[model samples]
Target: MRKALIVGIDYYSHITNLGGCVNDALAVRGVLERNADGTLNFPTPNVLIGTNDTQPVTKTELKSAVRELFVDDSDVALFYFAGHGYLEDTGGYLCTSDSVDGDDGLALSEVMTFANQSSAKNKVIILDSCHGGSAGSNAIARTMTEISDGVTILTASTATQYALETGDGSGVFTRLFVDALNGAAANLVGDITPGSVYAHIDQSLGTWAQRPVFKTNVKKFVSLRKVDPPIALADLQALTTHFPTADHDFLLDPAYEPERSPGQENDPSIPPPDPEKNAIFQVLQKYVRVNLVRPVDAPHMWHAAMGSKSCELTVLGQHYWKLVSEGLI
Candidate 1:
């Protein structure tokens, strides 16, 4: 089976405050759990994770947890993080909660080394923190350091930019991130592929907050191949490897089908109204209190609310699913 390690830290004793990193991490876990199938190609990911707000997330604990999760026999393994992060100056490092000004911060290379040693064939890293940019504090290391072979790294922004920080809510980068993930899979884009995710979040963030940025590095990696959506357990079984994409062809394939194929399949000319998409949409509607489709015309309170959109629902749903599936919610 595949494996996934999700970590989120919000309440930092000395680390920077992260209001929504842990929430985002857990939400990712939810999507992973619902999507996992125990087939040879598409196996359920065994999840391992820790959140700072819910529980104490220590550096040593995190290191050990990662080692245990990325076993030699694992298949598709994923590593996700949402928390306060910074770029260090001395040796070009990304600092985490445990990081100190001098030498405590975990080096990006160090995390990559652990990931490389894993046995999983396909691996992905998602970071929702900005690389350092403030000139005074040891120039932030923006270099795209290699983490692992055949590993894809998706960041909220490039080394030079900082993720958006609204009044007192999720970082703009991560907020848009969860939305894209939950919403992308069911859209015509097929499953929420990394590239598609980058596109949606980057655009939304740019529109909402000008400086918002998202970036990724694909080193010796092949793009995801789309398969028909899972209908039955048998269908899931047939899909040995299913990583949905936002490609037009995948969405339009005559033979390819999705879980909630509505109007389109039977009506031919019409497209489907994704219920999973609707559920998420509803959650967003309830939380944000505005129709995403009609946000421009909605009340000003929609924009003013701190927890707009089904942010809480999506976040909690993902967290609960990950914990139940991975045995570590």
Candidate 2:
């Protein structure tokens, strides 16, 4: 059966400054659950590190967790981490609860070694931490030699910038990463591709000051075997247009819409007597005018629109309405 090991650390005493590691751990789990095929369904991986518990993850705990999670002859193995990452004098160290205590903390090399020791056919390592490298440094270099032929490594940022904490006290990368993973319930089976995960995290954090970087050397076949893309806007628009109230709704409710700015809050863009609902309805109308693709079957529309693997605008169904309503095609 396939197995996954997800760890998030938001409470490292020394690296208490780092954000979202715990939530990141939860998010990674969500990603695996949504991505893993039910035909090959497997038990949840044991979580060894993070803020959900009291004590922090120790080297012994981490090593033990790795050994247990990547048992011999497993079909697939996945490892995810969200925590303080430091490029130390030795190499890259995934700072753990015990890391703050002494030098026994887990090293990137050691983590790689453990994976190499495993019997899994496919392996993926996801790290959302800062890289300790110089300008022009190849963060991929850190794991290239260590990664087996079937292994892939995805990091949160390039070797330069530090991963940031959101105002809510979580890492921006983790927040976006988790949000995307959680969104999978609205997508199709086997639709959670790695490219889609990257897109999810990418768009989720693109506007932020610090964006994460994803690096890989594994052949596309092995690395991307189970990856899927995010739900497309056209798909969401279509769902709303057709069923308008499907159980697995992808559209943001009026309550979830971003509030109007101070300049427009009291005095809405729409004039009086339009009905109070017009405020939100007007915004929704504008969205529908600009975003929906037209004239397609429900399934086809779903695929054409929400099947976006990237952040680009996808056209489906009624391109006519979008143009006329938004004054552009």
lDDT of 2 by residue, 1-329 (tens): 67878887766656454555676676566555644443333356766555633767866788777777666767667777777776754567777775763345677777777776667777667777776222122245643344566665666776557877677766676666555544432223224445566777776665646655654445552322233423334533443343322222333222322344346445643233334433433433333443532213333322322232111122432343343335331
lDDT by residue for model 1 (1-329), tens? 55677776665556565666656666666655543332233234433333454565666766676666666665556666666556544432444555545146455555666666766676666766665222112224434344445566677665556655554556666666666655543322134566776677666654434343323344433223232332332322211112121111101112212232335457755344455544434333432331212222224323312122212223333332333345331
Task: List where candidate 1 sits over 4 angstroms from the true fold.
Answer: 36-54, 90-98, 132-148, 166-168, 185-189, 207-329
Q: Among these predicted structures, which one has the highest TM-score?
A: 2
Best by lDDT: 2
Q: Model 2 clash tally? A: 16
lDDT of each candidate versus the true structure = 0.48, 0.54
Candidate 1 weakest lDDT stretch, 10 residues: 243-252
TM-score of each: 0.54, 0.57
Alpha-carbon RMSD of each model: 15.1, 12.6
